[model samples]
Target chain A: MATKRKQRMIFVIVLISGFAAATALALFAFQKNLLYFYSPSQLSEAEVTEDQLFRLGGLVVEGSVVRMPDGITTQFSLTDMQGQVQVEYTGLLPDLFREGQGIVAQGKLNASGLFVAQEVLAKHDENYMPPEVAEALKAAGGEHPVSIPKTTVE
Target chain B: MFTFLHKYASPQYFYSWSASWQKWASIIAALLMSVGLYYSLLNSPADYQQGETVRIMYVHVPAAWLSMFGYMVMASAAIVTLIWRIKVAEIMIAQCAVIGASFTALALITGMLWGKPMWGAYWVWDARLTSELVLLFLYFGVIALSGAFDDERAGARAAAILTLVGIVNIPIIHYSVEWWNTLHQGPTVSKFDSPSAHPSMLIPLLVMALAFKAYFFAVLFKRARTELLLRERNTSWVKALLKEAV
Candidate 1:
């Protein structure tokens, strides 16, 4: 019947959206914290209460990454280029954690301007950067801004 | 007898032509794959940053890519078969279904192996991985639906509809890592402006992709020939050809 074509269209849309929503719900459920969070600049400006845990995003500044000899505690300066914040944490860093890469840390800032980070996530080198972080970097006059390569251009 | 308006001039012509093309395709695909494997495994230098594990990118990336590419091809053929009722396009759906499914599964398995060492987890229920898993299931669904009926034509029709409907997953898989907080890495060579990987790495990856394409064509022609033969089994030309061979 002519309704077959309409039926096909409906089927396709329903399937696509169904898969999308299913994952969306699953991600929400699994990541109840869903902690892809705010940058250092945003955190500094916010009127946060004591022990109010939240995310802090920015890049780890060069020459600022130092591992403690104990290997359990470390400190680094996170920069948005325009402003910077010092973060102090006691834990193992992510393997991809290094200087000059984008990251989001979860914790609260002490009055001493130190971020007592509970968790730090480093972005993968698949050339993907969060849009918010990229914008912050751009506003900071950009350091090593990602340039698309010159050849085999597909 | 493949006599749907005689699109091939003659079924005999199609068989002979396809046979020759199939021979050449297999030869080229073999040569290309050997060279590609050589570069991927031995010749290429390890990524200075990611160390030797970066080599996984060669297979994992291309296989993931072809999985999506194969589905797109299948969906297009489905549309062609629906409107023109081309038997070859329907056969293509069958061929593409199996090839695409295998590649999708390969992408997933390799991804898991690569993830455990690098990402610190064997698997995460994130956007990129989950969507790709859905893609593999869709291919399986197509393969099952297409062969479900006692009537072959009816089966192909049902399979074709499902294949077209499943086309939405291709983009989802490609952009999942980029669009979400998934632990998956983003595209390296797929970007048109500039690729993230170095030329040394990109070249071998591209070569391997070409090899995969050539292999797809080689197998495709092989399967299509068998399909053509069976579809034309009742025709006079097929009988003549078989008699001559005997």
Candidate 2:
């Protein structure tokens, strides 16, 4: 009975410890590969790898929208209302996308520090905006869409 | 009926019953999972937006659903053990904890793997993801608390209290994605409206859910039986059952 009890304790310990160790090892091995989202300003100063796809968000800087001659590719500048970074996308823009509105572009940094967007999403207007977008916008500037007048905000 | 129910409350009776049930449950579970996995992986259509990556949903959704379902089972057993002083319930509760924790870990890991290709991030603080992580922690807490006390009964009672407390978090987790503006998509299956899910998607999801539930019952039955035998090794019924098997 005593030996059986000892075995039980060892079994429980091994299960928990084994899982914990495996998870820790996996996380450590992939630590650098873990993708983190960044605002346009953070990406500017952050040392981001060229291959790491990350989220970059900001207001589409007014009148900075310029499409290249290829017709498929477009270049625009994103600003946190403090700093600006150029972003390029070759895909079709999402509906509700417009200048001066919030957008999150998913892609990685190029060697020149330009954001090469694989996917571009426009933050839907006030009532449906995601919290992360709202917080990011808020931190960048007081761009709280919910608090703004519906007519004026849009 | 009362006497029959009462008989199984003893560790000795439970040990014998669990051994018999384990084999039957295992066979049923294996059969269900085989059908479910095959249909999910091969017959289902690739998602319109996600392409082949949507196939991961078959495993991810079922695992997530089972993790929650398993916790509920464990919590219910804990309540019964506490209220009725049933040794069988205690054994079931302990066994279910191990299995539930395993399912929760599987769900979290599978979700991360799916997220990498779909969401571009393996982990996110979105409401759904965070709440699921919390659920995993809750399972770990129950398992830890159960073993914390030197006296087994004391440990069980303490763990039971923790389980009851953790039940409150489940609903919060379910609605967290909806309540707060979250990046995670809302429910496709558990909805009041005509489900946004296609027939192909829905069929595989349901099959997988049933398969996972069966698997849980099978494993829990086996583990509970082992627990009962360990606790009641000196009892006459266990001895008789052992002799017969030999």
Best by DockQ: 1
lDDT of 2 by residue, B156-246 (tens): 8778767766676677567654444344555667764666566667877788888788788888887777777777788888789889999
Question: In terms of TM-score, how similar is model 1 to the real structure?
Answer: 0.72
Q: Name the lDDT value of residue B138 in candidate 1.
A: 93
Instruction: List each candidate's DockQ score.
Output: 0.16, 0.04
Q: What value does the lDDT take at residue B184 in candidate 1? A: 63
DockQ of candidate 2 relative to the true structure: 0.04
Candidate 2: tens digits of C-alpha lDDT, residues A1-154: 5565466546544544565566557645643333223556556565778888777766788798998999989899887766678999997886445677666688987888788999876542212222454466679987445211011110
Q: When superposed on Cα atoms, how far off is each prediction in RMSD? A: 7.6, 11.8
Those runs of model 1 whose alpha carbons end farther than 4 Å from true positions after fitting are A1-58, A61-94, A102-122, A127-154, B1-6, B9-13, B231-235
Q: By how many angstroms RMSD does model 2 differ from the true structure?
A: 11.8
Candidate 2 residue pairs that clash: none
